[model samples]
Target: MTKLLNVAGAISLLLGFIVSSNAVAVDEQPQSLSQLQSLGNNNQNISNSSLQQGTFNKTNRSGVLLPGEASAQELLPAAEEGLPPPFGANLFAGGYESERSDGLNDDYVVAPGDKVSVWLWGAVNQSEVLTVDNQSNLFITNVGPINVANVKASQLNQVVTERIKQVYKSSVSIYVNLLTATPVSVYITGSVIRPGQYAGVASDSVLYYLKRAGGIDSERGSYRSVKVLRNNEVIKEIDLYDFVLGGYLPRFNFKDGDVILVERQQATILVTGSVRNPFRFELDKDESIGTDLIKIARPYAKVSHVGVVGDRADGPFSIYVPFAEFAQFQLKDGDRVFFNDDIRAQIFDIQVAGSYLGPSYFAVKKDTRLYDLLAHIEVDPNLADFQSVYIQRKSVAQKQKELIDQSLERLERSVFTAPASSDGEASIRLQEGQMILQFTERARKIVPLGKVVIAENGKIANVLLEQGDIVHIPAKSDLVQVGGEVMMPQALVYNENATVEDYIAWAGGYSERANYEQIMVINPNGMVRLNATGALKPGDQILVLPKVDAKIMQNVKDITQIIYQIAVAANAIK
Candidate 1:
């Protein structure tokens, strides 16, 4: 009852404050679709109003809103420095593709069962929807029979126009449109989940059939390449990577008797860089592999050294091979061979500092991204400022320095360009020049690298990196935040001697329902700790977990055991 009364009081106080301040405007529906989306749009109207009121505080009058209850602008906007999306939402939102195919190499051939409309205006003034016969012949009034078999779809109008012109002396306009594609029964064989004939349209996407057949036979299938054959001749090859990365399907419409064969991804290796023909090839056990690779990937004559990165059971290992022995050198599965003709090209280096243990500097290859480097660096979750990992590039710093220089030069010009003045005015101009020079010097001292803001979803942000980029990973700060079931969740100033108990006291301690023993602390690196020694740091967040009264929770005993363990360890550390 006491806890309920306290919460009620806080609510009443917040309401009274808002009513007194008149910070809120008239309630109306959001003006646009963008307002409905949680895309971090600025909510500055209320904040600006608060500032105008001379002084406004949130502690004694904390006005918050539940979702669907009110807008963040009207209530609690995402605190400016917003939190991450609930999880996996932003990461996988992009690269999501539909199973429908919308591309084709051919302009759509008029096949049997295809519905086409041919309109003969002017001389004849007639329109008819004609289904192409099995023999690819279209019967027309007055024009008789016209053979359209194996004819390009784009040429259908020209072909029909000529035929229609024959029936009339006056020039007549003809329009031909393919309404729908003919359905095809394609045979999917070899290394497929369910190899058999699948019924689909000629324009149907390959994924549709694969999905219907329960996907590929994982153990025996090839993920890199699949062949689409028309009359035993390879018409087109489909690479799954295209669909995965770009959501684009191959432009090959299946015919009635088309065959899709999935070859096994065996003895696969990649040859890239200076090689003329860089591709992934599957080899047969009896075939001479090295000779085939040499014939396919024609390396330049000047390429003396080739870097062969081999993947083995122990770990990944690479070695340099001579150009002479490149053909004869034995290759294995999962081997990546890179050929570089220029032996002494300039190298690119980047520094990834803070929250990392290894050498801060790394000599990376071209087109490396922020996430690519982040994958290699290991930061303690409890200490990392994940939302704001930033990149500082040398080029940006140079641009900023140039701008400062230009501004200082402009100020110097202003003094010279000024109308002729008295000696006292001249003395004031000299002082102003000195001030501009000092300001310029200060601006130059400001580092540009750390200023590039990195959002929580950097990958989705599509932040690119250039040469001499410095990726900054921050450690936990000095002000610790107390949240969860605290009477007043807030950030407290940290002292070297302060513990979690001291920080909780600063937050008005835990609420009546808070589980004191089951306290959860998220360290500076975003790591969760149970029964942590509450040696609070600037960025550490202490959460007083809520008690679950569910008797059906099977892990209740285990959780209690873990909580007790944490309590003991934390006290011992203290």
Candidate 2:
């Protein structure tokens, strides 16, 4: 008994949760149904960052992949044996929601054959559902026929109250309500697909008759302004924009002789990109704002930013407007609007390759500089050739190669036609070929860093880095060279175990004129070291200094400049 009671309790809880989750209070029948379906669609597609509310759909960000990028279609897993389709149906204009609103209207006037609830109090106590006769009047048990066909809903209460007063002689109070409006014969005409009379409930919404008469002619009809006329008098107007902005619709009850007029769409505005209908909307002259364009376009809800293209006195130009500012802007004739979405990226990925001692392949915000990257990345002060550092981009290398190929073609053409003695022609050709080959090799060769550089005037130059870009730090070189006032100027194989004194010893030891304190070390990466004692890598350069009292600062500066150039040339050659 206890187990059965627990199972029943769990089932009840589950049922309650489902009902409560879908509950929403709405005034109208059609609006409530549409809102509920829209809510469910929104809840499923929404980002976890925001709530699922409002009539507009939740922003689905996964639709933004560019061309050539990988997609889910190519990598879909095997499907299950049986599975249901995804939730929500494809929405389009004149879909289920529009057709539903076309049903009977609750506020329709009491027409012939309609049912009305009548109750009397005070003098005579009675309650009955009276029927209206074919003559557009209602007949009570004791009272005769009372006309009510042409009256508006607002005046129905007064009209019925006065009729009851005449019968009861002011002694009884009357309570009357139109239970159901009779079937109405309405004529739908002008700029519609099927323009004819349709038999429908008198209380049905205008959308009902519009559908029965076939939907409005999208090519010629104006969705912005639709009208309902009665006895040659305009009774109501419809704007599709109202529903798009939230849930706003006209309240007009249909009558037997009512005529629906779908006015001709006059002005045409072109809408494209990320919208349901990339078609040109034909609207009235009064509808000239950005909000008006959104109503007709039915773009994705996430496309909050819009761009309007128009011709100006200076030529053609475009302006970007956000969703919040749509109402503040107006459109002109021959204008084209584009609804666009914001890119979800604000940073770029870059790499520090080669000999840099830092994390490789990280991201930085846009407008980042090589200098900024260098500051963040670590370079060995003893081995790094800082002066020869360059930034490289794959795209820049491709463009450079194209230019080099073009120049080579032109050079080959000029070289073959050069005037030369017939006997020496082969020699000339060989020499020029060698020269061209060397130039071509240099051009074809792309450095790890693609010659991108920030200015030396500022640590952070104005170089904008892109994704997959490389910042290379060249490797340490071999064969440390010893020069200056050494007894025997010589170069020795660089060894990690070799010290400054040891290299000098291999050069027959330092000369009497050598300055021990001014011993200099030049790395292949262009790093100039003074009085360095660290063990050297391959190709490291060591120069024993000469004794110089003649402006020691100036002499040291000159040596630094000369050694820096040599290091740069060595790295460039490779």
Best by TM-score: 2
User: Runs in model 1 with CA error above 4 Å?
Assistant: 1-106, 239-250, 268-331, 334-574
lDDT of 2 at 38: 30
Estimate the TM-score for candidate 1.
0.36
**Cα lDDT of model 2 by residue, 1-574, tens digit:** 3433332232222111100000011122111111222333222222222122323433433333456743322221221122221111011235532443323244556667778788988889988898888887877767777788776555777888888788789678888877665677999999888899988776676666777777777666767678999999998888764654456777666778889998986676666667776666655684487777776677896676566666766886556655567556777765666666544334566776666665776566555544445555556756754444445666754554454455555655565565666866566455545544443444334232234432121122335567666665655556778876577778788778878899889989876656677666755433456787667766566765444233312223333332232222222111
TM-scores for all candidates: the values are 0.36, 0.40
lDDT of 1 by residue, 238-321 (tens): 767556446777655678888888777666656665656555544443234456667656776546555566667788665555
lDDT of 2 at 552: 17
Instruction: Tell me how far candidate 1 lies from the true structure as C-alpha RMSD in angstroms.
Output: 28.8
